[model samples]
Target: MDKNIVFLLNFKINKASSSRKRGSRLIQNLDSRLRGNDKRVKVKKRKKFVLLSLVFNYILFVIYRLSYAAKYLIN
Candidate 1:
């Protein structure tokens, strides 16, 4: 199981001369950006999951065939 975890960090650096209060506007902007990033991550996760499952199924199939052959040889 390969998990690709993405960490999004938003840093706000304020200047000494700038105003102290940014109000709700800044919060709204950050919220929208975070939501967009979340959607992107979800899509990537879905793709990875599909690929992982395919590989797992292939490995299981190979093992099944090998065991079947071994049993046949023993008989």
Candidate 2:
């Protein structure tokens, strides 16, 4: 392990915790940017879920149409 890196990280962690009130969150006190990123990540996940549902529904519809066409042809 690099001594310099460990020292720098420790210094930062100590500095952040020292500045905040007792019993408050330590890491989150550093910045609100992380909170915003969490929201963006959640929204992206929601969009991906919506897209997957749409594709699944479309596939089911296609199968249904094919089955209906085959039944009519048989008759």
Choose the strongest candidate by lDDT.
Answer: 2
For residue 15, model 2's alpha carbon misses the true position, in angstroms, by: 16
Could you tell me the lDDT of residue 14 within candidate 2? 80
Q: How much RMSD separates candidate 2 from the native structure?
A: 6.7
RMSD to the true structure for each prediction, in A, is 10.5, 6.7
Residue lDDT tens for model 2, 36-74: 556557889999999999999999999999999999999
**Model 1 steric clash pairs:** none
Query: After superposition, which runs of candidate 2 have C-alpha atoms over 4 Å from their true positions?
Result: 1-37
Per-residue lDDT of model 1, residues 1-75, tens digit only: 112212222233232125436634445555666567655678899999999999999999999999999999999
Count of clashes, each model: 0, 0
